[model samples]
Target: MKTFLLRKVHITVCGRFKLNDMHILVNTRLLLPGRFTGVEWFTFETLRRLVKWHPDVKFSFLFDRPYHQDFVFGDNVQPIVAHPQSRHPFLWYLWFEYSVPKVIEATKPDLFLSPDGFLSLKATIPQISVIHDLNFVHQPEGLPWLTGWYYRYFFEKFAEKATRIATVSHYSANDIATTYNFDTNRIDVIGNGVGDDFFPTKEIPDLLELDSKPYFLFVGSLNPRKNILGMLKSFELFKLKYNLPHKLVIVGDPMFKLSEMQSFYSAMQFKSDVIFAGRREGSDLNKLYAHATALWFVSFFEGFGIPIIEAFRAGCPVLTSTTTSMPEVAGNAAILQEPENIEGIARDMYNLATDTLLVDQLKSKGTLRAQYYTWDKAAERLWDCINKSL
Candidate 1:
């Protein structure tokens, strides 16, 4: 093993090559067992492709938990589980910011990458932080006080210290640059790719029996930023105005303020029309997306709306918010409405459900639009940025 002391820590390079071999350390903190989200999917797919494409480079996946045997990697890729699982915020900070640096020092990696954004300020390694969005900076009221403070304080500092930064969308990249006063030149826009599984399936049936009528699908956590209240109100209006027999299917586990959502549900005029299908995976979610009247994802803000792209790929007409990155991702394939406008949402829902020609047009355009984003392209761009930074 070839070892180098770049900063205070020594990193070991395992692979021998005629060309200069760069040992890269990637933070795999978000890859918890049985958990999947947009960020996890992005990290997993990008890492998988990066390892495959670059055989000359040595890669290490550093995790805070025990390694899952099922996690796939290339021959040159190694897994390093250095810390025990932690739940406390203080412990998490200590583990990542303190313990991780020691591990990196020992390993002596040529480049350090933190995909979830925050990096240890103590480290001297050439670092790249994928600061997905500055949501905490923009909408602090939507998040818990401590959590919001931590993100705003730590991430801004991380951006400044990091050698390079990557974001999921152009909107996010601009926001990050403006918020942190960092030069836009240091930030790279690497949009996320829709998973191959989300595309239209011939096996999926057209109409599902959640009672007799089809349902409107809402995927993602029941959080304030998701604009769930707006969605419910819009659905109530749609049901009352059109007398539609369809249920409103919500497919995500509640992460915060359960009591608030339950209270809202109780007060709904058409409460009986709502169905909570809590956290689905695999073929079931694909089926839900394919059979829906249209995906209702009117979020107030987002780094990038992966579900919008997923719905489009699944041949479902989308009704997403006009705010943030939703319009950027949705393009003309979706029915974009203001998040605060309940009547606009109701009108679009009614339009999508009643108008056959509009639905057909959106479906056709979406299929072609969704084809533009791919994991290979994203991975290739990310690799190019990392190589350039090196």
Candidate 2:
């Protein structure tokens, strides 16, 4: 009797959505300022387009903390600022359980979307959660204890609760299905898109460090999973032996277990050749991408490497990891390197800088591949998923 009733409810919910008349409440906490990482950017890019594309359908953006003005993408979109930023574990539980659920109930949204892979168990509405990567499950020790615990426990329940699952890559889709024991059919593979800002532009005055020196660019948060140490070691090896007048430019904010990495960094033989550009965005990031030797991003794991496509858009070659979703993203376009193998990474970096024919070939392939992925295409696909779920 319970099973039969559940089936009826499911059919009733998924059977119909008057697209023009529907309302959606999005968890826009990730869209706030000082957090334009891959996950946040994905949500912002998709929603900005979605709101404009569907004028009749109202989109309510729910932020857990004080909202930003730039997040208001359209007049058709409504903004709801709730309480508790939920930077900590207990706050996270409270926000999802009490605050967000209450807001949903009051809003009476036809559907709910959470791009951060968090779904409110209290909300009865159909929900779409974007599970970028299951790194917490795969690399538990990389994260703090409470964070890892929350992710492992709540995410399993959220996966079950989510009306539909959207993953960035087929690799991640498979992982989610196998790890969570979720239905594969329920997962939708919507790949991330390259932003418009990453075009072939002239270098700005911000980075005078790369004035005359050939350089290899590494763009990712300075963390263990990002293999920053590995990259540094590889760069050290390349400069020591090759004696190329090339610098290593690292662009990202320091995140997680950095003391040891910092200590190691200070002891580098070629530390002077490595320049940390810090976290960059907008025009500065585009300039960095535009005028780079090549992107060196051999992460240990990823749902999707957005920078691979960003480099593609910038008309720059990429040396990404052979493992995870990178091989899928590159698609014979960029050079693939083993993340853990520092020697291999160094060899590839050297090859990218020295070999003209190889670099040109990669650039050509990368530009062509970049065309296939754009914000418009991503928005359309995401909207289709949203429309169908409605």
Candidate 3:
């Protein structure tokens, strides 16, 4: 691996240097082994395509810890493991502010790409950072004090520091620009995509041990912004109103505010009906989506609702919030409801449970809508953003 040390004269404007000479430094810390979330999937799916499509371009993926070779998509790609696993707010600062700059100084790549939104404030190179959402901005109580403070303090700086911005949706882009007073034109919207693993299944997989009773599904971290309490209240209302045996199956680990989730769960009248299945992914997650009565993802805010598309691809009808990017991603394919309207959510849940025709219609529309977003398109848009930054 040859290292290029020349500063600003690496490429000419009118006739650029050979494409083979281009080198891109990437923040790949989110690509954790066996822990695939929305941001992780976005990073992996788009990067794999970018590396494959541009075989001559060298991409140096910087990881904070030991990386899985599955993330290294091509021979043109180089994986560099940096120090200090950035799990906490303090470590996050050290890794991005100090360690990442050290790597940048050493490599001297033409550009730096940060998919997880964090940026190196010390770097002089043109950088692109993907600001996923302003969840912490809207609802600071949703996160821990230190974590929320870190975001509030540094994210604004990151927005100002980036040469170009990429986000999962237009709602996020607009929010970033408005909140941070940054230029909207500099931001690119790269929507989320569903992998081929998620699809409509004729029969539920044997791994999921559910009874004959149909269930409503909720997929995401058990955080306050997800409106876990609201969903629980809505489920209680639905159970109280109807004599049906429909269950509310929550599939995700308790990421934050676990005590609140526990308190709500303990106080429920139909607590036995709510199943807490911690974190399902890949084909197992697909099985849950395909067999669910409907996906209830009425969150307070979201940059992009990945599960809504996942459910759509799995032939599951959706009932999501009208706020932020949920409506943008869902289009006319889902039943939209206000995040705080527990009655409305319950009513929609009841409607889905009883109305077979409505469910079928949503399933058809959702599958069609899911076709619009794909990793290939996302990768192309991200690559375009990289090119524009350069």
- TM-score of each predicted structure versus truth: 0.92, 0.93, 0.94
- Cα miss at 66, model 3 (Å)? 1.3
lDDT of 1: 0.82
Could you tell me the lDDT of residue 322 within candidate 1? 88
For residues 1-390, could you state the per-residue lDDT of candidate 1 as single tens digits? 454544443333343323336889898878876688888888888888998888888788877666664554776777766554545567568766776788777768888888888788888989999988887888786777878888888888898898999888999988988888998998888888887678677655333447657789999988878988888989999999998787899988776545666777899889878988887777788888988899999999899988888888899999998899988888888888999999999999999889999999999988987877778878987897798678
Candidates in descending lDDT order: 3, 2, 1
Better of 2 and 3 by TM-score: 3
Write the number of the candidate with greater lDDT, choosing between 2 and 3: 3
Question: lDDT tens string, model 3, 274-322?
Answer: 8888888888889889999999999998999899999999999999999
Q: What value does the lDDT take at residue 23 in candidate 1?
A: 88
Instruction: Please count the clashing residue pairs in each candidate, in the order shown.
Output: 6, 0, 0
Clash count in backbone of candidate 3: 0
| TM-score leader | 3
* Top-lDDT candidate index: 3
Name the 10 consecutive residues with the lowest summed lDDT in model 2. 7-16
Candidate lDDT (C-alpha), each: 0.82, 0.83, 0.88
lDDT of 2 by residue, 1-390 (tens): 011122111101111224457899888887768768899889989989998888888777877665777887876677776666778889888778777777776658999988888888988889998999999998776788889999999999999998889888899999999999999988888889977788888765277777677788888888788888888889999988888989988988887877777887899998988899888887788877777889999989888989999999988889999988999988999988888898888889889888999989998999999987777887887887787677
